[model samples]
Target: MTIWEMLAVFAAGIGAGTINTIVGSGTLITFPVLLATGLPPVTATVSNALGLIPGSVSGAIGYRAELAGQRPRVLRLAVAAAIGGLCGAVLLTVLPPTAFETIVPVLVALALVLVVLQPRITRAVQRRRDRDGRTATPGDRGGPLLFAGLLLASVYGGYFTAAQGIVYLSLMGILLDDTLQRLNAAKNVLAAVVNSVAALFFVFAAHFDWTAVALIAVGSTIGGQLGARIGRRLPPQVLRVLIVVIGSAAILQLLTR
Candidate 1:
C-alpha cells in the first residue's frame, strides 16, 4: 500500500474501532475504506474482519465493569455465537465474491433500519415490562429464546458485521430485562467472539492484506479506549442518528460501487 493508502486505512480503523465500541457497526467504516484502497471485495472483508479483532477485544475489556456478574450469560451466549460465527466464516470462504457484493447492500440497509428504530423498540420493551410488572435485576439470565435470537444475530455478525451491536442491543433490551449498559457490555463480548472466531478461520483459509491488518489493529485499539470514554457520554438520540447516517453512507457506497 502507498503511504496515503496506509494512512487512510489507519484512519478508517480508528473510526471503526470507536464506532464499534460505542455502538457496533465499525465494519461499515473499515470495509469500504479497504475497498477504496484497491483490495478485492472478499479480501477486504476478510482483512477487515481479522484486523478488527483486537479492537473488539479492547472494547470488551473497556466494558469489564459492566460485564461483572454476567459470566453465565456471556458464556451461554458465546457458545451459540461461536457456532454461528464458524458457519458464517465457512460460508464466506466458499461463496462467490459476487454473492457478497450483491447481498451486502441489502444487509447494510437492514442494519440501518434497525438502528433507526432502536429507540421505539426500547420504549416498547419498557411498556411491556411495566405491564408485566417486571424490573431489570442482576439475577436476570436470558433463556432459550434469547439464545436463539443471539445465534441468529451472531450468524449475521460472522457473515457481515456492520451495525451488529444494534441488533444485539435490541434483542437484549427486549428479551433479557437489563439496562442498556449491561446489555451493551454483553454485546461487546459476543461480538468479539463472533469476529475473533471468524477471523481465526479467515487467517487460515482466506486471502487478506497484512499491512491493512496491522494498521487497523493499532488504530482500532486506540479508538476502542476513546469510544469507551466518549460514546457513553453521547445522548442516545444523537448516537442513534450517527449510526443511521454512517450505515446509510455504507449502503450508498456499496450500491454505487
Candidate 2:
C-alpha cells in the first residue's frame, strides 16, 4: 500500500474502534477504506476480520467494570459465535467475487433498515420501564433470544461486518439486565470473540493484504482504547448518524462503480 493508503486505513481504524466502543458499526468504516486501497473485495474483508481483533479486545478491556456479571451469558453466546465464524469463513474462501458483490448491497440495505428502526424499538423498551416497575435482565427470557442473535450476527460478521453493532445493540437492549454501560461491556466481549476466532481462521488459511491490515489494526487498537475510555461521554447518536451516512455513500459508490 502507498503511504497515503496506510494512513487512511489506520486513521479509519482509530475512528472505527472509537465508534465501536459505544455503538456497533465500526466495520462500516474500515472495510470500505480497505476496498478503496485496491485490495480485492474478499481480501479486504478477510484481512479486516483479522486486523480489527485488537480493537475489539481493547474495547472489552475498557469495559471491564461492566463485564463482571455477564460471564455466563457471554460464554454461552460465544460458543455459537465461534462455530458460526468458522462456517462463514469457509463460505468466504469458497465463494466467488460475484457472490460477494451480490451480497454487499443486501447486507448494507439490511443494516440500514435496522439502524433506522432501532431507536424506535429501544424507545418502546424504555417506555415499558417507565410504565411498569418490572425490568428485564439479560438472563431472563431475553438471554436465549439474544444469544441466538449473536450467533447469527457472528455468522454475518464472518461474511461481511458492516452494521454489526446494530444487531449487537439490538440484542443487548433486550437481553441484558445491567445498565447500558454494562451491556456495552458485554457487546465488546461478544464482538471480540466473533472477530478474534474468525480472524484466526483467516490469517492461517487466507492470503492477506498485510500492509493495509497492519495499519488498520494499529490505528483501530488505539482508537478502540480511547473510545472505550470515553464511550459514555461520546455523542453516540451523532456518531451513528455519521456512520450511516458514510457507510451509505460507500455502498452507493460500490454500486455506481
Candidate 3:
C-alpha cells in the first residue's frame, strides 16, 4: 500500500478501537478502510480480526473496575461465546459470503430496536415480577434465555464482527438488572473472546496481510485506552444514545456496502 493508504488504515484502526470500546461496531470503520487499501474481503476480515485483539483486551482491562465480582457470570457466558465463535469461524470457511450478507443488516437493525426499547422492557418485566411478589437479586444470572441469545450473537460476532456489541448490550440490558456500564464492560470482554477465537481459526484457515495487521494492532491499542477514558465518563442515557447512533451507522454502511 501507498503511504497515504497505510496512514488511512492506521487512522481507521484508532477510530474503530475507540468506537468498539465505546459501542461495539468498530469493525465498520476498519473493514472498509482495509478494503479501500486494496485487501480482499476475506483477507481484510482476517487481518482486522487479528489486529484488533490488543484493542479488545485493552478495552476490557480498562473496564476492570466494573468487572469486579462478575467473574462467575462472565465465565459462564464466555463458554457459550467460545462455542459459538468456533462455529461461526468454521462457517466462514464453508459458507458463501452471501449467506450472512442479507441477514446481518437485519440483525443489527433488530438489535438497535431492542436497545431503544430495553428500558421500557426492563420496567415492564420488573412490574410483572412485582405483581408476582418476586424480585430480582444481584445473584440473578439472566437464565437460559440470555445464554442462548449471547451464544447466537457470539456466532455472528465470529462470522462478521461488525456490530455484535450492540446485540450483546441489548440482550444484557433487558435481561440483566445491572447498570449499562457494567454490561458494556461485559460486552468488551465477550467481544474480545469472540475476536480472539475467530482470529485463531483464521490463522490456519485464511490469508492475511501482515502490514495491515501491524498497523491496526498498534493503532487500536492506543485508541482502546483513549476510549475507556471517554466511555466510562458518559452518563447512562448518553451511552445508550451513542450505541444507538453508532449502531445505525453500522446498519447503513452494511446495507450500502
Taken over the whole model, the C-alpha lDDT of each candidate is: 0.81, 0.74, 0.91
51-127 per-residue lDDT for model 2 (tens digits): 88888899889888778767877787778778777777877888775665566666666666655666676678767
Q: Mind giving the per-residue lDDT tens digits that candidate 1 earns over 28-86?
A: 78987898899998899889888888898888888888899999889989999998888
For residue 135, model 3's alpha carbon misses the true position, in angstroms, by 2.2
Q: Say which candidate scores most in TM-score.
A: 3
Model 2 regions more than 4 Å off: 98-135, 138-141, 234-257
Give the per-residue lDDT digits (tens) of candidate 3, residues 1-257.
Answer: 99999999899889989999998999999999999988988788889999999999999999998888788889999988998888888888888876887899899999999999999999999999999999986546799999999999988888889999999999999999888999999889998999999999999998899999999999999889889999999999999999999999888999899
Better of 1 and 2 by TM-score: 1
Preferred candidate (lDDT higher): 1 or 3 = 3
Candidates ranked, most accurate by lDDT first: 3, 1, 2
Count of backbone clashes for each model?
1, 5, 0
Model 3 alpha-carbon drift over 4 Å, by segment: none
